[model samples]
Target: MLFQVGGQGTRPTFFEMSAAQQLPSSVRAALTYSLGVFALRRPFIHKILDYEDEFFALLMLVLETHSLRTTDASFSESLYGLRRRGAKIKLKKSNLLTNSADEVRHTGLRKRQKVLSVVFLVVLPYLKSKLQSTYNREREANLQASLWGDSDERFDGDFVTGDNNSFGSRDVSNIEASARDRCIKRVRKIVGACYPWLHAGNEGLSFAYQLLYLLDATGFYSLGLHALGIHVCRATGQELMDTSSRISKIRSRERERLRGSPWLKALQGGLLSCAYAVLDYAQTGLIAAVFFFKMMEWWYQSAEERMSAPTVYPPPPPPPPPKVAKEGIPLPPDRTLCPLCLQKRANPSVMAVSGFVFCYTCVFKYTNQYKRCPVTLMPASVDQIRRLFHDV
Candidate 1:
């Protein structure tokens, strides 16, 4: 009797395994296959379907308050179990098999599954991509605005009270500004949908983004000004006042456009001006400090050399040679020519240490680069050269 009971249990287990094998695969697999087929036919569909699993998983988590695996198991198993259960009901009602009730129930369940498959595989991805594109536009607009500043240009003439030329220009400016503002507003609205803090009229966030941009602009301007100053000090003798005035004008214009009350505007302007002044002063002071240090170093070196030199007394000179003047003989080659170029010295100058004559520009350039005399190879400097005036 125990052997017979075990045999019966084994028969049911075999039947169940057969039934499970006949059941459909998971809903996620079905959806993925459908999306893959669609993407193959329409290449652009791939963009939305690339993250199909993630999107469906997130949707399931939000709606059912469970993970994708749990939800998928429940969906696929329940649908297959329902069909099997309905078949068992039909078997019990075999006497009334001619009644069509089982067929109607099975048909309804199939229709419901079809609708669900369509929604998950098609509708959800389309909506998500649309929403994503809208938000993307807004983010792009915000980035462009921050980097390039506002695109709007102010019109100097009034539309209604101006002459034909002025009216035309004003109209054109207004049209351009309106188009640009419209685009910006559309993008901003989309961004605000995702991040409400970035919505229009959110003064705090807007001001913060603008302040960061201002700081970046100020830093770049300061660097450029510093470079210009160095160029002026080395190559040209121009004053910094002109550059300062131009920068002030630009700052004033920017401040005028900034959103603020008169007092606030004035305060910000003052702060920026102060910052610019500090930068200018720092650059100028650094240049002056370098020059002062160089002068002190030279003084110290000269003092040391003077103290290190030997003090020797020379013997008296012999009788002077007789003076002879003969114009017929060819004179020896002029030794005053520049050794570097072997040419008559133009703009003649003397190196203080070597007491040698050379072209002022040639020797000055050489010393400035190498810090030594061209002929004697002794240490020299451009500053120690004295311009020589010859009586022609």
Candidate 2:
């Protein structure tokens, strides 16, 4: 028999054997296999799988709710444990799938779940802010290093201050004073340069500059909204009055001058009568281009004739009236459930002037790309449209 002993110093007690010390190869091999199975069943290994299954199930629920479909085997492989750099991925692909019956119950597991939920809900928001700050710090450091050579102690890398003072201003007050004087000179020169377009009421050029300033303020993606905004902006009553007054004065002066130079007027009339040549120099914006064409066409015409022309001003253009199902028409609404989504009930709002009725939502969803009305080749509104169908 071997004696087990304990030591107070650095050495650990080892099992002491008799003369027949070494175990046989078969016994050692069996012991190694047992140790491998025991190691594989460690608590932490199970814990990851448990969390992953729950996490993946939640994700699948999310994707399914958003109309995505998937299979189980693919999801299983995703959840299988794969060690990455220290931090673990919270969810595995296999973890993304599980049925209600697969759920396990344990009081401690529930408490741990609550703890996880609290961490995600409470700490995750601030985690992003912390990450943002870290990114900004790293970005600023990169900018500093790029601008100036790294210091001996990382002279080229990120630094609070640099060796070069070339970009620095003399002082705030001196800079401001000099800036003020320069601004005054710049303002004067800009006024001189813009005098022609300004007095000429070049609305198109002015709108371009306004749009560019807005792009600089916000960003590129917002250009569409801002571009559309320009129409509403200068359409104000005050702006309209100013433009009208300028155009009226210009036209009146031209009419008076033309009375004395009929020969010159005739000469200009011949050259400018070519509509395409006149429109070649037309300005930006659809409305502006139309206005320019009208101006050029009516420029040499009599002012009396211009004033006498029936004007389409102020009142907005009216939209076409809804189709009145042509007196004796029958609306053939196919009452059927949607096979894809299994939604029951046909939508009457999307009655194809030809009589086929579909769910307004489905009709529009399909029609958007197809550009054909589900029932007929009739047009449809792209806006989040509400349908109003009156019974014929």
Candidate 3:
């Protein structure tokens, strides 16, 4: 049922079209995750990476808009030899002379449909991601406030602490305070009541749509497309032209159109045409390259299936340096005594910075006060005190 013949065309398999549709998004996510990993150590780079979703959304908007405008297909759809068409239901007026049947016609999407689809595809995802992030932040804040009872303390402070009579009118102050308290309570109540339902609804809808998509229902590949009555179909033979052939045709048309112009003018137009062709090829090459690299990455990361697959053994560690003989023997430090307390070690702890042993209380107090190792005087903090299981 994925394909039906009104006019003969090579219908793309559901999986092929779906894969092509998801390819760009997959590429975007992979790139974002990779960049985040690489930039983890750089605070500035991490800050820039935070807006990666927005940046990709903008890029998709431009690419999809351009592809849709010129080719009647989004970028992925064009790459996959598919185009978006509006499915219009036409009713034939009952006529006595000849009988006409109601039929569905498919044509390029109108301007309004194109705009709406682009907004859904680009804006909706951006807003959804932002809303999810906001929800997480609010949830974490509320959890912390609940655990520490900070929210209650703040509310009490706001309610009980009124402005001085000398600073403001008593009636005005009470009114302002009451309004603020009510607003805060209302906001908290609304967020608590609605967020759970919103989250559950989003998850349930996504799961249902995915299940439908898996069943290969027509016009259900994308929610936006289904909602807007836009259908993706294979480009027929006459509609699908090779890129090179199209470029040649364009060049011929330009040449004929510019025939009466001066040689210089004609030359300029020719250069521009050549540039456009090159740019188109470059885009195609880039898409192919991305797919190639992604495939290679997947192949390498996947576990070997056959026993004959090559196994790479790491180089063995270098042999330790030969022990050197010394002229004088040095006495080792007393193991039973704490360095700082100078007594039998009790509840011993070690300074992580200096790796020196001391009584836990002694080390904790010293680091808390001096912020340094007692023996080595190296900069440290109370957090560096690590308790040792073994008695010194």
Candidate 4:
């Protein structure tokens, strides 16, 4: 059975105290929701439009950190005030121990404090985890439709293959495939714009989480040390106030140096702004280079095939008999027949080096076998032959 405690002093009861202690957590939740829905969500519209999700997550992180620090400072101040008030009340109650009402009040306060501690430490964390789980589940369900498309509702079996369908079905399948690809692309863009850190595993307790926690822990540790130092100075009756003032002056000077230096600030800002652009350009260039090299490779393979292909030659005709000529006169040459085949020309072409016309097949076969022109016998190749437009 649970016991009840009643109090009528300056001290608050268990439920009231617990509610007061949870003020920071409540403020943190409100700030997170406000920043996420109002501030970060505004970027989502612009982010989706721009198709660039690179820095939105980083901005969200900065805003979240600022909100957490603000709430934490408030909570710390409130806790310090409560501790000081409690100490004062305890001292007064000790002097009034002879009063029965004072004794009862102290007992009730102690019981209430214990109950409040349990509620805040145990019950609150469990509730927070349950709420987070529910939120994640709902978010996943809503976003899933944007990724998988109507396929989830349509096909219950494996994808069809091997051209076993009618033309209409094939066209329908092609359209569905194209639609599915488009849906996947849209979903990727939305996810990237809304939550860049999701891919980087910073959505939950990750490096960013640990780093922020460490900063808070260090700040609280320093505060604890400062409090301890003050307590020690008071106990020893030492004058350390001047020393602390000097230290503060030094810190202020350092801060001013950091803040006032123009070059350092510019350098930092430039790095932050241009680092992602450089990385993205580098990635795109690398992909383009790979595709360009693949195209070049395919071009080279096609050229090699053309070069190695066998050239077909129609059966060579008998060589014509040399015409006898008078001592000082040369016989007129035949214009209708090819010099290589000694027959009627078929698909005549011309050699660039010797300017001699020959049949296309005859010249290609001769060049492939002998690599020389038939008339001049000069060094010639298949590439030097040009197809003639006129019939021989």
Candidate 5:
């Protein structure tokens, strides 16, 4: 399936090589993460004072509220009753019937009911207690229905849902400016600590996140936010974001600062690092999948004599075919599309790669070798100068 296209002496392309060619995907992904270093060149700045101001604003709102619960007592009772009766809302109809021992063979209804009861009695009301007036508004949740097929058995009785846990009612009303001061002081100390690259003088964390997000290289930045979000939520005895308007703002700004600090190198260095990271991700995804399946097999066999496997749903239906070429219809016209990102937009460069013209800027941003041709998935190189063809 893979034969080199260039001359014999030239090295084989990345796409042509097997995934064992690189570090394990998980390891590579971990290594690719920016520890506020080696990625972003130009950081974007935000006003941290805005976060401080909003925290106090929110604190006042909470203090003013006579009743923390938005809905009346009757409505609260109704919601509680629904939870007690095991009225678990499965938006996707198929999810309602999933793994039912009678049908799908692994619902674990009794266990699930027990979990639901704990959530309703202990967690649900506490979470509801912290909701802001706006949070009480009707909200729409997105659903992704997929089909999964796995050869592992360990996942048989496991159930997954978005509602993993609920928070309890508490006056996170206590999370104050002292907490804010301490958090900021701690970060300042950490960034300033004994690392040449992580110097606060060299990079602003806020700027780092913005640039990395712009370059689509936000791996650790997001993880940092999630871990910190959990940390803040627990420390304050309520949702961290609910502590106060100002604290919530600080939470956001904190994530922005911490995540952004990566890739905040001098411009050229940042761009090169981003290119390296993204290319690495695309290159390593396959290895991760294979390893995942292997792990599942090992776990399933180890679980018991015949434990059921994790239910992996099948992939959703394929997207409708493009309208560009209907049978027997003429092409509308040659339109410019982003040669790099591939998302068509206005003002694309009309340069050729593999005899097709594309936006030069798009191609400039796109990396070859690691992630090759957009359409064909073949190895690519820029053809800045026209190559001549002749009869031999």
Candidate 6:
């Protein structure tokens, strides 16, 4: 009975609802929640974050009530392209007295429906979130108590605490309290067993409603609207944005003409100008904020990927193409002979800058003095005369 189909006019499609309603709501919540998380380390900020839902509810209630009163739509609905109207009630006539047909009324949201819708929009979500949070905490505590054999402490409030003195009084009290204890224990057990099922059932119902809404079988996108006898229809150029703009322009012209204390007028003008500017550019600013957050998210993800990726090193410089004696330098026919020393290499060392080998002492002395390979006459250094051990 709470959820009815078919409105007087065409209902907004699911995509329109998602874009105009769902996306903006999600972005707004995420933006505030992100700010809270960023400043969560500060005690005052953390306390504000703890009551985030309540704060959000109060803020949204004010905004929504204003919007509804003025434009028959919420801020997001007006900003994008949707408006809420009261669902039409159909009256069917019975033919026993006289053959009368059906009638449909075109009345917009009544005062009661408007109030109910606003409460459902702003208050219900906050209450639901609180209930879910409390349930989760209680469930976790119950689980801990069960695991650690601390059930007595957890259930202390569920039972009566009696006096230790007076044995006869205690006996009478025990007899009277036994039934109450059993009833309370049984109820607690039943509730404990039913909580999971209740949660699942709520989720299932929400999903079903969402599916129905998506399929256009429901006149409202959310249960709140449906329960309050409200319908969302595609907004057709009746938004208050244009009216607000015109009013702003008229106020600006009037303010410019009005006479006042020069300094006070200047201050008022500055503040009003800033407020008007914010109103005009709020949508663009929200878009820019979303873009900036997305860019930051991408940057962080890329940085993380770079950190997680494996590093690579260039393959060790290909063993400097097997060192060869210079064409002009005369050398022994045996390639194993050091080109500089002209003897079988001993403590052989190579000049890195040029492809030639010699005894470490010979290369060190020559390069230290001339700073070049003796065989190739190319610039080198004593540091480049790396000594090699005889493998043989």
Question: Residue by residue across 135-180, what tens digits does model 4's lDDT show?
Answer: 5654675587667754457566866667564555578788999899
lDDT of 3 at 83: 74
In the range 122-203, model 6's lDDT, one tens digit per residue, is 7766766766666666678678877886766656773445755645667778787988977866765666566678779867
- lDDT string, candidate 5, 1-392, tens digits: 01123322212222222221122323323323321123354232123222422432342233212111211111112112110111222344565567533221112124444433334323433333323211222111111112343313435675544554432222253366658866865654443343335334324774575456445354212223222221000012132234345444643463454433445534545565564454334323434544555575577678854566566899899765333223212322433444344455334333233344344454444533334344333445555413324211
Candidate that beats the other on lDDT, 1 or 3, i.e. the better one? 3
**Global local distance difference test of model 4:** 0.46
In angstroms, the error of model 4 at 26 is 3.5
lDDT of 2: 0.38
lDDT per residue for candidate 3 within 212-250, as digits (tens), equals 766754445656677888877787656666533664676
Candidate 6 similarity to native, TM-score? 0.53
lDDT of each residue in 43-145, candidate 2, tens digit only: 4555544343344344333322221111110111111210001111134446566632222211111333333323432354244334444455555655776
| Candidate 2 segments exceeding 4 Å error | 1-362, 365-371, 377-386, 389-391
Q: What is the C-alpha lDDT of each candidate?
A: 0.48, 0.38, 0.69, 0.46, 0.34, 0.66
Span of 10 residues, lowest total lDDT, candidate 1: 228-237
Please tell me which model should have the higher TM-score, number 1 or number 4.
4
Relative to the unseen true structure, what is the C-alpha lDDT of residue 321 in candidate 6, on a scale of 0 to 100?
55
Using alpha carbons, what is the TM-score of model 2?
0.14
Regions of model 4 farther than 4 Å from truth: 1-17, 28-131, 134-155, 163-392
Q: Worst ten-residue run, lDDT, model 2?
A: 78-87
Give candidate 2's error at residue 340 in angstroms.
14
Candidate 4 positional error at 323, Å: 99
lDDT for 55 (candidate 3): 79
**Number of the candidate with higher lDDT, 3 or 4:** 3
Off by over 4 Å in 3: 1-11, 37-44, 91-102, 151-218, 242-392
